[model samples]
Target chain A: MKRSERLVDMTKYLMERPHTLISLPFFAQRYDAAKSSISEDLAILKHTLATNQDGILETVAGAAGGVRYIPYIGKGHAEEYLGDLASRIEDPNRILPGGFVYLSDVLSNSQDLQWIGRLIATRYAYSDIDVVMTVETKGISLAQSVARYLNVPFVTARKRSKVTEGATVSVNYISSSLDRVAKMELPTRALKKNSNVLVVDDFMKGGGTLTGMEELAREFDSTVAGICVLCEADFDKEKLVEDYLSLVKISKIDTQKRIILAEPGNFLTETDFSQL
Target chain B: MKRSERLVDMTKYLMERPHTLISLPFFAQRYDAAKSSISEDLAILKHTLATNQDGILETVAGAAGGVRYIPYIGKGHAEEYLGDLASRIEDPNRILPGGFVYLSDVLSNSQDLQWIGRLIATRYAYSDIDVVMTVETKGISLAQSVARYLNVPFVTARKRSKVTEGATVSVNYISSSLDRVAKMELPTRALKKNSNVLVVDDFMKGGGTLTGMEELAREFDSTVAGICVLCEADFDKEKLVEDYLSLVKISKIDTQKRIILAEPGNFLTETDFSQL
Candidate 1:
């Protein structure tokens, strides 16, 4: 294959399987090109990705060395995206009865999911997240998005039991919204023992659901790599969990006046985009 | 940017947004290259993709035209993937109590989801699918995977109501497993009227849940573009709905004998891959 053709195929191949190593010998054999030529092609691919500030092609130097694609984003890009997302989320039409905001529209959007996934993956790029975990229904999309970019499988903990799953590990956390203890369960075989899990969700009220996930992680003898939510209700909220990150913080939601206030959360300050 | 660098970025861009049109001028401007140069880059991409038989880079000609990246697999590729998937589903260990098979592992597997999503997307690539719909719990992952490849938003119909989603549209369908009438609901604002919806699910027995989604789609003045399931059980079975596609068909599951039978469904023979 020609250099141009090889570059295109190489890019597509690397992007599909992120965090995986592709040795120079393998690329040379696949393209029927010389090892030196394959190395040069990778250099071009890596440089182009860096120039765009969208990804990183890390080169490992050793006998078992190769290139690993890391999903990274520029600081300017992150700030601009989060700002726009927060503005869209500030719309009062999303405010529901009892102060809950409707965010299914944003959660369901493919483009939004891509950006959100890439950003979260960028933050935890080096964290070695073995699995992505989230409580069922709303958090499924967010968890799936992050899992896609990270090239990892995501498991959802269900609010109620379904016979389809053979055996489950259940945990209870206070449903702060309703002020009741709620139970969530995960299939016993869904997650491996001692895996590093990253917990994600769509919304965080009193952080009760997150607590449930944290406890569930403990039951499996797994460690919580991080906790992140798409939106956090900052105002009318006594938080149950701490040391978590939110992409957008909802400071206020006035159902009577149909007003909502939102801004970028601690994610902006906590994430080190300077590495890009 | 040089041709080498452009090829890499172009591939990444196209992969990120599958089944979406990208104008030549957009690529030309992004790469700071001429129209002819961008055309040459895309030609290289198309050729490489065709050679791999894994994707299709379709060129749209006219005043409002550029290129589209469609995720498709050749017939041979689909057969191989489904064959492997069927064998995995045939494992006796997957059999749960009461004829139910455990599929949460397969549903959560990113690699498995990628192939399944591509296969389903290829079958309905040309269908004017305005939205993708599925019921909550297990089906969310399947819906998200298909929606990702289709580049469309997917909304889940919930089995239970939450305070988050305000007004809703609920429908009833017989729960085959439970042998009772069951209800599922979607937020009123989740789906638009007159949409062409594609219903998808992880597993289908009586297909009561699929019917509920169909009725919900009808309430919104929408047409069912198609219905597809990841796995369909033919053992111990009678089906409630007909005229649907199944990627994998489970012919038998003997709990006492510790045996199972599975194979590719009618979907393989029914789909036409000639467009690629």
Candidate 2:
């Protein structure tokens, strides 16, 4: 194949399998190009990605070495996307009967998920997240998005019992909003021993669900690499979990006045984008 | 930017936002390149994608003209992937109690989801699907995957009530397994009226859940573009849904004998890849 054709195919392949190492010999074999030629093609890819400040092509040197594509975003891009996201989230129409905010529209958007996923992955590019984890229903999309960018499988804990899953490891956490004990469980085989898990969710109120996930991680003898939520209720009376990150923070929600306030959360300050 | 760098960046951009139109001027301005040069870069991309039979770069002419990337897979690739999927699904270990099959592992894998999403998107690439819909739990990932490739938002119908979504449209369907009438609902604002929806799920026994989704779609004055399931149980006595596509068909699951049988489903034969 010509160099141009090889470059296009290589770019697509690398993007599809992020964090997967494709040996130089493998690329050479697929393109029928010389090792030196493949190396040069990779250089072009790496340089082009860096210039765009979007992705990183890390090349490892050794008999088992190859290239891995790390999804990332520039500081400017992150700020721009989060600002727009916060503004959209600030709309009072999203305020629900209680203090909860309706965010299904933003959660369901593919473009928004891509941007959110890329940004989160950029923060944990080197955090050594072995697997992405989230609870069932709403948070599944967010988990899948982050997993896609990290190129890892995501496991979702369920709130109810389903016969489909053979066995499960259950955990109990206080549902702060309801002021009741809530149970969450994960399939026994879904996660591995001593795995590093990154917990994510669509919304966080009092950080109760995140606490359950953290407890579940402990049950599996796994480490919590990090915890992040798409939105957090900053005005909530008290929080159950600390040391967590949120992309957007909802400071206030007045159902009577139909007013809501949202802003980019600690994710902006907590994430180090200067390396980009 | 130079032509080589432009090709790499353009390929990534188009792949990221499939089915969305990008004006030629946007690329020209981003790269600081001439319109002719940007056009030339797209031509190379289009050709490379075609030669691989993996994607389609559709160009629209005139003032609104630009480019749209349509995710697709060749017949050979589809066959290979489905074959592998079926084989993996045939493992006796996957057979659970009461003739159920464990598929959370396969559903959670990012690479597998990518292939499955691309293949399903290929089948409905031109089906004018306005949104992708599925019930909460296992199918959320599947719905999100298809939605990602289709460049549309995906809404998950919930089986239980949550304060997060204000109003909902509910439907009742016969739960063949439980032999009861089960209810499912989607938020009223989650879907738009008169939209075309593609229904998807992770597993189908009698397809009761899919039927409920169809009814919900109807309530919204929307048409069902298509219905697809990742795995369909063929051994089940009856099926509630017809005219549907399945990526893998489970012929049998003998829990006592510790045996299972599976094969590629109608998805491969039903799809017309000749247009590519």
Pairs in steric clash, model 1? none
> For each candidate, what's the DockQ?
0.86, 0.90
Q: Report iRMS values in order.
A: 0.9, 0.7
Please state the error at residue A128 of candidate 1 in Å. 1.4
Worst 10 residues of 1 chain A by lDDT: A233-242
**Model 1 Cα lDDT, one tens digit per residue, A184-247:** 9998999999999999999998998999999999999999999999999888557888889999
**Residues B1-276 of candidate 2: C-alpha lDDT, one tens digit per residue:** 888888899999999999999999999999999999998889888999999999999999999899999998899999999999999998898888888899998889999999999999999999999999999889988888999999998999988878889999899998888889999999999999999999999999988888999999999999999999999999897898889999999998888889999999999899989757
Q: What is the lDDT of candidate 1?
A: 0.90
Pairs with steric clashes in candidate 2: none
**Residue-by-residue lDDT tens digits, candidate 1, B23-87:** 99999898889999998888888888888888899999997999999988888899999999999
**For the second chain of model 1, what is the TM-score against the true structure's chain B?**
0.98
